[model samples]
Target: MRKNVGFHSVRSFSDRRWLLPFLASLLVSFTLFMATIFGLFSSQNVGDSLSLDIVSFTTLDDFENDSIGTDRKKLLDQPAIMQEEAPRIAYLITGTKGDSQRMRRTLQAIYHPRNQYILHLDLEAPPRERIDLTMYVKGDPLFSQVENVRVIAKANLVTYKGPTMIACTLHAISILLKESLRWDWFINLSASDYPLMTQDDILHGLSSLPRNLNFIEHSPISGWKLTQRARPIIVDPGLYLSKKFEVFTTTERRELPTSFKLYTGSAWVMLTRSFLEYCIWGWENLPRILLMYYANFISSPEGYFHTVICNSNEFKNTSISHDLHYISWGYPPKQHPLYLSTKDFNRMVKSGMPFARKFAKGDPVLDKIDRELLGRANGQFTPGGWCNQTSSDEMAEQCSSRGDDSKFLPGPGAERLQQLMKKLMSQEFRNGSCSSLQYDQTKRDWITPKKPA
Candidate 1:
């Protein structure tokens, strides 16, 4: 009986020891499982609160109930808004010695509050002449009030046939881009150039057109003259010298380039702001490369922009084959176009060109254009919607006071310009743009149409 009792007590003690350990392990596991579930619920509550806070801060009441997919679809379906107002032009009016007055006249003729103007008198002009021009620009009440006219304080020494002319043009364009953020096109003119239409007419005519068009008369470099132009290397002294000098040729000649084809065109051009930006910024290396290559080429102004535009795929299709200037050349042509006169007035009026070039200083024909086409008198601005008067007495003194520049009063000149633009934008002209290699046969050897006999 004693042995049996001792054995039972030992067995019971061993079983109790194991049973206690098992109970402790079970209790620990249950506590961990409860903690994990509480942690998950706490995290979910915090996430919901953060989402609510973001929604409340942004105040997107309309979109609170919208799904992300629905919002994206709505945004995709919305149409893009476009500007409907008349486009603004940036003008660079350049001149040499004794051209200050002509430059001012041209500026006044083309003046509009909406347009930006930069007048450059080349370094060849005396300091007195430049100062006189600055004084004239500052002294005018209208110019001062509008503050759209600017005179380049530091002028460039420009050789008309050299790359310096192109440099000056790029300089002016850079200034225009910096000063005004809204101009659509850039038009370059010389002191000898004159406007054939009122600013109102021009603004109205340009308002309906695509902003990407660039009016540059270009053709491929070809024939015997191509060898004459391409083979001989020339250096322009105007790049470094303060005084004017002709370009000198080197004895060594170079082979024509195999990489890119060469093109030539009229120096007078009306270019889109976007295209000029591409040239000026040179995001691609083509503009800079061509600029360096043409540094030694004769008549670089006529070819630098021409080559860059035609070679660039981005702008080649955008080129138009016209320079939009009315210039009369003698048959078989001279170094310059014939000096325009009253004899050419009727022809100039009928040509539907907005501008003409190579007019002599104080030409009588300018007065006829001012009187008949522009409706301007008494040395005032060209009459337009900006400043027109109904009174007969006020008609003589119109544009003397400020008026609404946003309004456009297009007239017979607008109709004429529209006709010309229509023809230039037709399918035939577009199909041949930058696609042909016609050689320039006119004097100056640039691509320009001969005056109709």
Candidate 2:
């Protein structure tokens, strides 16, 4: 009986010891699983790893929610919202020979954390300059980290005022679409162009508008001009040659194209990614037809996209018929607008246009714009809340360190931009701005069509 009792006690103690360890192990497993589930729902900035130090850029400040706008504040306050209302932009800044520095400056002027930019030094530029451009794009720290900005690796020779301009534009768009998935809009600009509004203003303004609306100036071609432009058989050598060449006119001009009515307008445009996707992706045949049609046309960039958008029944009404660029032309209207100077600065500001074209490189007006309009110091990024590295004591370059990118702090520029948005969206201008433009002298922004001659 003594041995039996001793054996029983030993068995009970051993069983209990094993049971305790098993229970402890179960508790630990459950605790670990709970911690993991909690972490899965927590917030994480998507851009923590992705950085784009587009060459020639100085900094990128973490985006602040309040800094963005009022509407974004509510959405950002919630932890499980899982997304931001603020959208991304992909820009194509194209420049010709000797315009490389201006392209860099325009890029720096419009730089932002939520945007992707593709710079193109067209065939008009020397190979050395193109290499310089690529070096700038690849060497920037912020751009390298973000991995957002990229220069066209395979440069194409472009002819001024020819089909190659359109080709280069399309090529850049294709590359941007393939390389990045975050952009909402595709904007094309030239070296002679510069930004009038801040990124904050433009981004915030776009967030409120429908994503389908395309900002392009367009007009229906008719009568004498239609017959002349439609039938012109011009061949561009830029597509075939390895060196600089001009477009040649065949001694033959054909009759007007009855199949599709010709449309002509400003080449500058802000196109939606969806429309660009339609053009790049072969889901529809309309874009393909227009591409072939404009292959031999003069100034095809000015007409290809215009015709494509207008001809497509699906995309016709989506046109806003405004290029969103401020261009001051000579009294008689020359090929390019007069060089913008101090005399045009106030008018430029009051115009409330986000972008302006034909500014001479190294012009003092550009310096004045950088100082007064952009609030940018020499050789630095435009001041914005994204830059936190600046000292709190005064507005300074503080983006040396970055914080959360989800936040935004918009400024007066945003409000003025909103007014411009309101004017564009008003019912009075809706139809007139779309497919039909009627110029109104009272409002410089209003367009009234000239009678068919």
> Which residue pairs in model 1 clash with each other?
none
RMSD of 1: 13.9
Model 1's TM-score against the true structure? 0.77
- The TM-score of predicted model 2 comes to 0.75
**Model 2: lDDT of residue 64:** 30
Compute the lDDT for candidate 1. Answer: 0.82
The reply for model 1, stretches above 4 Å from the true place, is: 1-82, 388-392, 435-453
